[model samples]
Target: LSLTLYALPYTLAERIAGPWSGALAGALGSGGAFFLFFANTTDYIPVLLFSFVGILLGFTLAWWRPVIFYPFIIIWNFLLFRLDERRAPAQTPHLLHRHSAFWDEFQRLPLVGLDTHLLLVMERNRQEAEAAMAYLNTTRQRWAARAAQIEQDARQLMACHSIAAIGEAYHRLSTSEATDSASALLRSFSRISQDVDAAMRQESAYNRRLALSAVEDRLDGLLRELTRSNDRYAARFRPIAAHWREVVADVVQQLAEEAEMRQEIDNPYIIGVPLTEKQEIFVGRSDISSHIEQLLLDRRRPPLLLYGQRRVGKTSLLNNLGRLLPSTIVPLFVDLQGPVSQARDHAGFWYNMARSMIRSAQRQRDLILPPLARDALAADPFTGFDEWLDQVETVLGEHLALLMLDEFEVLDMAFARGRLDADGVLGMLRHVIQHRPRWKVLLAGSHTLDEFQRWASYLINVQVVHISYLREEEARQLIECPVEGFALRYEPEATARVLALTRGHPFLVQLLCAEVVALKNEQPAEERRLARLVDVETAVPRALDHGSFFFADIAQNQVDLTEAEVLRLLARQGEETAVPRQVLVDYFPSLMALENALIRLQKRELIERIGDGYRFQVELIRRWFARQPA
Candidate 1:
């Protein structure tokens, strides 16, 4: 009966165990009982047999893995299967991993790319040198003739006082392609030309003509700076000219290797599209939506300021606000890029706003305005718009009208340009909010709260909410959740690398993951189940270059010249630290210019005013800014 009892457990365990596990279980069960049977006859025998068993049991018990493996073998097998699946197929590679050492040496790049960037600079300079050498070898005289033309124009501009002759000289200098660094050198000449043009055009200035004559000394000083200093390129870079081919060859080799590596990845990840809006790929912005929801639920219904850097998921949040907010408030997406952008003045704004509000209210709530009032809004919106808003309020008594003005910077731009009356528009909105407590404005822009108040003065009453980068956990969700459907995963290490590289910037997180997924598709089908370390190393550079296309215009279009120069100066240094106030002051020289540039950069959220100096709020922007060519 005791044997039967022991045999019953062994049979049940074997039924659930795999082939090897079942055999081991059967052996242990039968052998243990047999040994015990003999041991029962002698205390020393039992002690001798159980001594080793006890030791092993004690060790194995602490591990719990081999002992616990019985129930979790399926999970273990799954992991093994995935690991085996990612192993590269046995074949000769197109590029024999030569760049592995290159990557090893430069692995700290992207984080501290300033030194590595010198390689690119040197390579570019050498290529220019080679081209110049080729041109001199091909037609030395024609190049010399153009050089003479540039020199003659430079001399004439310094001494010649005629404005017409100055314009011609500037034009000649602008259109030249002489010398080794002619392309970079002309930028200085161009700025001087612009300064001369502005000075000559100054109608009110008393010393305009004298200021224009200063172009002579300006041209002389600039020529010295360019020819002597070699502005953006190295004048004596020829020492490393022989080693230049290695840098170009390295990138080329990496590209070829990447192409081969990609051939193994199928259906790689794609970017240039948002994730959360797609619903299937939506991820963690609960950090944002949760606060917005609670704010919406509040009875105050005060105006909101949704501020973030460009492309930080502000539009996505706007699209999702209605779904995430409580049912008490109605969110009508007021896209200024929509028909509302055509508003040129206060009257036009009222007309366009009424059209949008009526259309949105009807579609969202199936509530239609009376035909008479709708006609009144379309014809004379300046007066009837207020009445129609009252009717909308009557239709939904307790429900609030949460007006989300996206890209509200458009109005600020229009106000700055004098096309829209800022006081009139701001006053109208303020009056509406004051009378109708449930009617609140939710304004979002690439600018800041101080800017809104500066433009309107009435916006001082509004509440501002700054949207920063996603949290690490949220960023992880963005990286992992979307790829779940493809039965693909970024290996935990690769995921951490992504989080570290992007630093929880949402757009960057999405963009990098998308590049990773696309790069992943190039791998052999069998090897694409998980993103590996090499895959991350390969994808980062490509992703950075690709994503920078979106940011290339930020400095050009967003800030003025002095602001851009300050930003560039900061970027050139790389990394964030407490820079002395004097450093920036020296960069700008003028106190007013320095203060204006810093303020605009702050309002744009490009950098922050922390401590005595400032640092980039988004490290990725700093990385991007650092990579920019001088």
Candidate 2:
């Protein structure tokens, strides 16, 4: 009883203050228990020693592994209880009767202690769950912000008017890493934008309607996709989709109203700018193309000259030669009016040439040519260029290359300015013509070989192919049907009047017909479709005003003082009337100077000798000259 009372404080200290503090108190309790046991009897000395060893093992385990220590403590207590039951069976009943409540309270202590470990595990799980929820919330916020940015970019795409601006907005939207539905919808909008641009550029209302119908079809598919998708951002895009539909409908209605106002006032004719190969309005070059093809087949492969007056479709012919020639014959067109003539040195010139050749081959025939770096031509440029041509020839295989140099006069200007060496440049061309059997060269210019004496000396056996006004039938085709589903019709007399005024000149024909369409548009809708002779007459002054640049170039640049006087004299004589050479001689002091001016005027195709007299070649030009001050 004394030992039990002394051990009570030590057991309570072990549960409350941990093993080290409890050990100090336990030493005192153990000393008292030993003293009491020795005083009473020494029979339980082995059991006391065994109990001390078990307590030491439990402390050792608790210091190393707290998890194992709890189970060890439970097992050790059970073994001790069993041993005491066997050794003190007679005393157990008396002790149980006296201390039943105390033993029951002691058994409940382990259950209460086990709850601490479970509480620690529960706290760790709670912290992990909270961290996971925070990450998910942050991810959701980031996705929402990205989706909002994509929506803003899509709105900017819709507001774009030009192809360049639309493309830029689409680039931003695509790079935003939008959802699949958003990407698909952006692509649909891009297609619709392209279709609308094409429709606005179309000359015929019928063609415009076809393009707009394509836009409508694409929009319908997009609407169906939007309906099927359950994307979170779907609600955000619904209003934008509806607005796009309304915009397309408004475009359709506006085009319909415009169609009714004027059937052909969209002005299909291209003025000043050279016609592209794909343009349907480029008509009546078959004869010139055929002549060029025949010359190309010559055994000597002479350097051909496409000689014509200014604005006579020379560059246009060069641009379209790929379509005219056989597929085996590749046309590499270099426009000297651009960077080629502007190059400062031989290396720069050859580099630009190579670049143009490569681009032209790819664009025209889908043929990939070997690349040439500008550094490759830094030293010995001509030799470097020649070596590159060897690679080009290997790519050509059995095909022939037709190199067409347009506006050769511009390159000549470069030479005259001393920016280029005339001898070195012309000699290289001469060497190419003489040495390269698989290559043919064609130079298009306004001046004749005789005018450029240097070119006359270098390019021997040059065949001249003159490009003039269009044929009568070709002019008619251009007038009535420039493109498929042409909206305007021409009466026979009206057509004949156009032929008289333009003299079948390609530029003048388009100019006069465009003016006639403008005139008819001002009248009632009923009179817009068919052009009458009165419409042709009423459109003349407007045509002259609209084509003032074409007319003024002839007076200011193409002719000198003597040639201008000769033109004015011819203009004074009516449209059809011709002045005899004898009449022209009276206006000039020097006969030789008068004859020289007449020869130059005729060579320019501004005048023609008709029945021993010279008359204006185009009536429109004559009227333009008549309006000019003497």
Best by TM-score: 2
Per-candidate TM-score against the hidden true structure: 0.51, 0.64
* Candidate 1 runs further than 4 Å off: 1-278, 296-301, 344-348, 358-375, 416-420, 453-455, 483-486, 573-604, 608-619
lDDT of 1 by residue, 437-475 (tens): 877788888776665565446764566677867888778
Which segments of model 2 are wrong by more than 4 Å? 1-266
For all candidates in order, the CA lDDT equals: 0.58, 0.73
Model 2 residue 424 CA deviation in Å: 1.7
Reference-based lDDT, residue 384, model 2: 91
Clashes (candidate 1): 13
| Lowest lDDT block of 10, candidate 2 | 93-102
